[model samples]
Target: MNKRQILQLVILIIVILAGIRFYIYIDVLRSGGDAGVKTGIVEGFLPISALMSLKKFLLTGIYDYIHPAGLTLLIFFLIISIIFKKSFCSHICPVGFVSETLSHIGLKQRINKYLFHTLTILKYGLLAFFVYIILINLTVSAIESFLNAPYNIIADAKMLQFFTDPSRTTVIVLAVILLLTLISKNVWCRVLCPYGALFGLVSVFSPFKVKRSEENCTGCRKCTAACPNDIQVHTKSRIDTPECFGCFDCVNARNCDDCLKVTSGMNHKLLPYVIAVLLTLTVAGAMTAGLWKSTVTNQEYRRHLNVIDKLSH
Candidate 1:
């Protein structure tokens, strides 16, 4: 398969993995492994843990920041953007995968494209209404409920039961997103996902962009045609537009199928992962060191008590 097809398959796998992981975690917790999470590691390198701590942020507003999922997700996204600008959304995002696949089969008709574009604006509106405004006014309980309500009650707890319930709206929404992806194209990500909105906002700052090399341009318009996100690749001077998802389909250097010769390069920055790795290491080290020190001190105190009892005897 071509790069695009390969990327699509990868995205499908990631989505499936994420769903399964969440499911398994919930089941494991229910099986009474609640206090058995092995989060601490040597020098603070958590192979499977999130970059930052969102579990605390989600479970309680106090925000101790244990195993932050959201912040780590954002950091990981930055690394991906650095390698290939917005490629995560274009190539990996489950929602994007759904939409692109659907575009090929279900939304191939002209009317489908028009309808998809028109309705996409609703996603933006929903973000503005629900996330920016409503979430702040409500309590954490309310926020959790809303987040999990569509799937199950979020109340900051594991949600396996929600998935088990076929009648639940949470399952329905996920089903709808998947169904629409096969039928429509990235309908959820493009139009409704507040998380995408958040990422898009930061992605505006992405440095590595797809640019058109004017000299090499025998603009046959294949790039424009091949672009799933519908970017005008031939004429645009700045290829790093917000909508551009860093899928390098137009470049001639990487592959021959490219419509025009494009000079795709990075900004002054290399991989966004550089910064994230450093930050993650620092935080992870600090957490490990701090916890380890405390554990050692407690053990020493216990030893001292035993010595004192032996001396008294």
Candidate 2:
């Protein structure tokens, strides 16, 4: 009905559309693989082909960004994240953001804010574990299985097909984690998402983070209470906590504007640099997968010796 309400509605609409797109991708995969023409089967974002081909990128660090549907979207949003400090997670990450908005609305006046705040830290731990595995045991073939996953009953899945059935390990893990998110607050962004971790790292350099003019301290601690993420706002020198998701809720509060300014930290803030890194990864990753898919077709290896024999003759 007012300014805040209108802004909330706009954000809700954008986030909902993003969620619709993501959910549709999953359904298209589960629909016995017949994905109709409207499904963006050939389009870059809906194609689901890049994940399988990510093997090449994980192995050698190269990629193609023009073909697979997710490459462009991920890179595009990732770039925006560079300028905005994980704005995608706050503004567009459909599922996670939707849940956060709902929970914050109901709990704004609750007495147990600390309980929800502590619970969200779990996401950071989970995110760390995923990265540890990636750094230590990341195998291209194994990850390929997750992204391209083959279907048992359907033969038309253009997405990569691993043994015609996924291992179910990741599926179970993600399912349980999502169930936790439904019951808990911001479990994914707070703990489980590697993307969030990447943003957290870059956010350290975000010039426009919540800044407090110590001179204007009212000591109300309301900003801290208003923070859905539970950042310690009343007494922190630098508000560069890993938990800060750049949502701007604290700074936008009615009483907290002058106290907290989104000050610029650098002429070339960490935001741009992080965006560049993620974009590089997304683009390079896509290109690497595409080239591998084209050149290393299992058929090419099979024909290798046959061509060599002809050359010897």
Candidate 3:
């Protein structure tokens, strides 16, 4: 199969795994049992806690037990970005998959050029704000306090509530975003997601890059037109744009095999296979090494949920 097809399959597997994990967690929560199995991957959604854990690790030299899996997954993705140029977005993230699927339903029109240029900086701005808040405002003590807060303890439950019991405003906002996604390609990832911005920053240093062959003599601009990120692939010998999610749309530009390739001192054709093998190994190794599950017990989780329930009432 082609790289794009292989990537789609990978995305599907991830989405299914995530769905099953969340289903089991929510079911266990509903059953009111301390013995219910929980999925630690759900903690990945709690980025705030992961950031606090990162700070705590830096300051105390202690690994995060509160949400170990989340922090590990975050680090894993960051490393992948450094090695593969944000393949996590194009190959693994469920949100990105959904966005890509929705983008297909819309007219293949670009966002307005002027507005797109202005809005593209917003994700970076959001990333900067997060950096300032986490690095500047949080001391070791502050990080400890926040990570151990009741709200933090029950954050997974709270996230479930956000979806299972969404308020009118939440529903409306989601609907609007959905509608907008059906009209624009990757609006959220391109303009709003700070996570993507962080990955993009790390991806700039990636050795793996799309290199255009100057000697091939094809300036057809198909690569540029095919790029979801709208990178000027025809004009540059090497695409170093941080916005690139390594989708390889440029390289996949039909009949341009010799004209474009992704490389990093190795065979570019093995890129997809390498990504798949690395991703599988990372996840499996983390699990076998006992870094894929939280230390927080089911009893502790249930107790925290009860407290949150009482507070809400």
Give the candidate number with the greatest lDDT: 3
For each candidate in turn, the TM-score is 0.58, 0.56, 0.89
lDDT of 3: 0.77
Distance (Å) between predicted and true CA of 133, model 2? 3.2
Candidate 1 segments whose C-alpha is farther than 4 A from its true place: 1-25, 28-67, 78-84, 105-107, 112-115, 134-162, 168-183, 213-219, 235-237, 252-313
Q: lDDT (0-100) at residue 268 of candidate 1?
A: 20
Ranking by lDDT: 3, 2, 1
Question: Candidate 3 lDDT, tens digit per residue, 61-97?
Answer: 8877777878887888888899888877876776777
> lDDT tens digits, residues 1-313, model 2?
3233334456457544644553454355354443332222222333223433333455767553223444455446545656666655655454455556554544334435577566656656765665566545657666554443222101122222222244588568766755655555565666556566656665565565667888887888877766656567877755777567666666656264567777665432243345446545765665555521222222322333223323210
For all candidates, what are the clash counts?
10, 17, 0
lDDT of 1: 0.48
Range of the 10 consecutive residues with the lowest summed lDDT in candidate 3: 304-313
Candidate 2 lowest-lDDT run of ten: 152-161
Write down the lDDT that model 2 would get: 0.50
lDDT by residue for model 1 over 1-313, one digit each (tens)? 3455555576467546655655554455444454233222221222112211233255564322332333344455656555555656755455466667666676453325566667767756765665444435555565444333212111112222334454577877877777766554456666676555545655666655665666656766777766766566777755755556655555523223333433434432323343335535744765554422222222332333233323210
Itemize residue pairs with steric clashes in candidate 3.
Answer: none
Off by over 4 Å in 2: 1-55, 58-67, 105-121, 141-188, 191-195, 254-257, 265-313
Please, what is the whole-model Cα lDDT of each candidate in the order they appear? 0.48, 0.50, 0.77
